[model samples]
Target: MNTTNSIQQALFHRFDREQWAELRQSVPLTLSETELVDLQGMNEQLSLAEVTDIYLPLSRLLNLIIDAKQQRSFVLNQFLDHKVDHSPYIISISGSVAVGKSTTARILQTLLQRWPQHPKVDLVTTDGFLYPLADLKRKGLMKRKGFPESYDKKMLSQFIADVKAGHDEVLAPLYSHVTYDRRHDEHQPIRQPDILILEGLNVLQTDADTLVESRKPFVSDFVDFSIYVDAEESLLKEWYMQRFLQFRQGAFANPKSYFNHYSKLTDAEANAIAANIWDTINGPNLKLNILPTRERADLILTKGANHLMDKVLLKK
Candidate 1:
């Protein structure tokens, strides 16, 4: 292992991109350009090279961890002298919005499914657990829609618990970005998946109010592994603005889109709006809630200004 900054944070074992890439030798790229295009988010150029260097190694490491966990479960079951219920392994991917965590989740799901284990994998985003627009408005939290309080944390926690308890089927709400609301009528059925990847902004966060009140499990408690995507504040701001412009040119122009009004703005006007949103909402959320939990993740992928992962930090 590289000795750089090893003493800075004893809990994390850091590895540069080159070092991490070497760990994934001979792992063939399973995804083609067409599939990559569909899995990636808009405005983010995710090439096969990047997948091979970063995500492929990540998937390989996860396979090892899953194997180890299953072996341990087998021993425990034997010790108990009976069959013990072993739920699907859950992975939590968290980061600020527009940081490519969604793309990472999708890529991982595809890769893990292709592994020899042939585990049934399902991906769920915390967006589905957010309070409905009407509910947010009624609670006077419309402006803080992505904040922790804007989500039904109790319900979200319960849903994860049920899935982790080996439930046969669990129902989660569906959310629509175009409508910018939770689709209450639609429910996504998550059956007995061998692995469940839970991605969201607040998946790793614990409600501050819940700290002193109860011993309830937070959504993260059910996660067998967790990853956090990280980048400099300035770079994240730039990415957010770029994505906003792309949306203005595409989705925002649609009449049915919630942000349709933004399509009429000039580039300068749109930039100003994006800046304001970052400063007021997303920025604060990252500093206060999200980034604070970065160390809580089992692995942290640090990105450079170009959105390429430059370093990885694994919890020792």
Candidate 2:
């Protein structure tokens, strides 16, 4: 079979944009333009039409799933003649850098929380789980910042386990993009949220080496649902470069920002630097680590060159 035919026969049920939009049914658009603008990333162009067509239906589906799971738990508790503690339903979103994972996470968090059954949704990024700058430097992993080895996998896994065990309060480490490191004195307290959305570059990664060596569960193991945002490598490169340039004029311009030195670079120099970073770090990580995890996700959101989602592939 040809490549396209093989993909069509894969485990996912593919839906084009129009077909996916039709699934929205009667779901209302709860987000205003202002709210969507605030939720967008540096170079993203998220629109109300996109949310109405794509995210609303997704939210409705998630609501039904959550309700069904809760009902199942209740029935099981009755069968066991005991009250089991309720745990948060974890949803993980994974993708390459600049693939708009954060945008999708934030939008979903907002939409999912609006549902009456589960009004409390929390969002956390895996950046906070990355090792401190000093630790990375000591371990000689500075250049491999976003790689799986750079993260404190044990701590991250334990955190998920705690949250999944229905802990009354769990603290997640805080990360600062401005400083490009984890904050030692700060943490976000998660208090029994109905749903938790975990966003990261490698949340779905299941490295065989790590699993064989550690013999422990991966972070994705606790995730009840997972999504992967995807795009072609060329488009991802272009988006990364665009975001880098925008940051040079915006966030990098801050004197305290870790990347402040890049603010003074001319357009050509910035582009060169961005391209080198992508080619050396992000690109390799994507090809070796992130992309491999795409098929592991319960759903895949594929984007076009214009940074708009064109299709969805949901696991059958």
Candidate 3:
């Protein structure tokens, strides 16, 4: 079974506006108005129509994978002559900042909850694993907070390992994006669920040492499925600037806001700040770290300028 260039192309399903509508009709949503409202409340950008059409079938597919993963784990345990411990099915969602990762997580939680088989899905974000504010300042990494090196790789990897190990209770650190600090004292506990959705900018990353040691499975190894949300860098810059403006109007209004100065900035100034941030931080991170990991994902959701999924690329 040697490699061959004849390996087939990874097919991407391009759904035009009409095809998307027909797909929605094919898989009508069972959601009630109240649940739809709650979902909209979480991600204002996502319409109920998007959820019912794009995510419902996606959730159905995931439930199948979750079930299969449990079976696979059981067989592997029997092969190893070890006890079978059915862990939560883990799916990771990684993308650039402001690329709608939070929305994707929320949509998944909502959709997965509706399925009887996976009613207890939990979403965990890596924001919690960042170094505390004092620690960041001490390390002189305060300005580079979202960079890969700023996080506790060992702890984050361990958390995933524990979840995959079927630990009954896992505590993850929490972070305050508004205050721009890690809330280490505040440990968020997560009991086992049918599925655990880990969403963040860099969940796909792994330690170099882990790679060198063949026995040490990468964090991605624990992922039964993964998605990389994609959008053009030019569009991402515009969305980032738009979100920064929105944050300035809302969160930054608080005097304690880490970006309180943004609240006082003129629209033009805030736009410039957002642009600078993208050029300096997010852009480089995407090109250097995040984009390369796209190959590791089982699926890629390619979005258009408006951020809706234009196509879904599934690795065969």
Candidate 4:
């Protein structure tokens, strides 16, 4: 079998229930509580064990690719008489909301950093590229927040292109979940790093409309590898609803919570509302716009009913 199939077979072969047990021995996790807290948006706290098992080997394998890519590019550059920085490899992680793409990105970032050659792995979510709620409202897209039309596609494309071009620094907007919007006045500047994992719902979009409107190269064109988190629609709906209720009881109870208004509802009420929203908005976006891009990914991590990855599909 090829390397791709070998990786898939290794992952799938270890997918028995409680497979994390076997994974733990191979990929020891040492994430501190603070690190987990920092990555909470992706449920990093809940999935650490699985992260060790699934992402560690994957990270090691990617480092090998990064090295090979650099060597190949160096040989080509020698032939053409040109020079370019061998900057970090980038991985794009995409999936429907609450499918745990964020966590996967964070875990992979942390794991890759543990490798000697890629000690400076960094993660940036696509949320920062989303238009602020205020902008969305003015554009009359408040009802369609989180949809493809709600992003500043031009800016997002430019950001990716700048990073790929090895700009001294690339700035990205910061988002405030409390305000449920972008913090326009503040930005985070990323210098070049050894590895960058860009994670988001629509990170894979490259439709003609986007190309025309953004007027820049598609982000995926820069990805060295990409992953799409896969799970049954029913399981995703359940996870989304459960996470909604959890957030309501925790974050939403805070006055600063953007979703504080929902804090007053009972769990049943929150579940119903979350389900309805998912069915109308998130589910449709995943089905119509996002999942079609699954074929563009280099690897897929498919979760079972227990919310564990049971099978991994690698593209040939």
lDDT of 2 by residue, 59-90 (tens): 98899999999999888989999787669999
Question: Model 3 residue 42 lDDT?
Answer: 19
| Candidate 3 clashing pairs, residues 3+ apart or interchain | none
1-316 per-residue lDDT for model 1 (tens digits): 4543444278897899899999898888899999999999976887888899999999999999998888888888899986767489999999997799999999999999998773699999999999998899899988787888899989999999999998989998999989999996899999978899999997887645254765778998889999999888898999999999999999899999999999999999999999999999999988878887887889999999677899999899
Q: Candidate 4 has what TM-score?
A: 0.85
| Candidate 4 residue runs with Cα over 4 Å from true position | 1-49, 77-86, 208-216
Task: Tell me how candidate 2 scores on lDDT.
Answer: 0.92
Q: CA shift at 124, candidate 4, in angstroms?
A: 0.7
Better of 1 and 4 by TM-score: 1
TM-score of each: 0.94, 0.97, 0.86, 0.85
Candidate that scores best on TM-score:
2
- Clash count, candidate 1: 0
Q: What is candidate 4's local distance difference test score? A: 0.77
Tens-digit lDDT track of model 3 for 1-316: 3221122143344455445445434555776667656654212455566766577767767777777877787889999999867488888999998888878887788777777766888899999988788888999986677888788877888998998878889999988868988775788888888788999888776554233555555678788789888888988888888888889899899998788878999998998888998898889988878886776678777778666777666667
Arrange candidates, best TM-score first. Answer: 2, 1, 3, 4
Give the lDDT ranking, best first: 2, 1, 3, 4
Compared with the true structure, model 3 gives a TM-score of 0.86
Clashing pairs in 2: none
Question: Judged by lDDT, which candidate is best?
Answer: 2
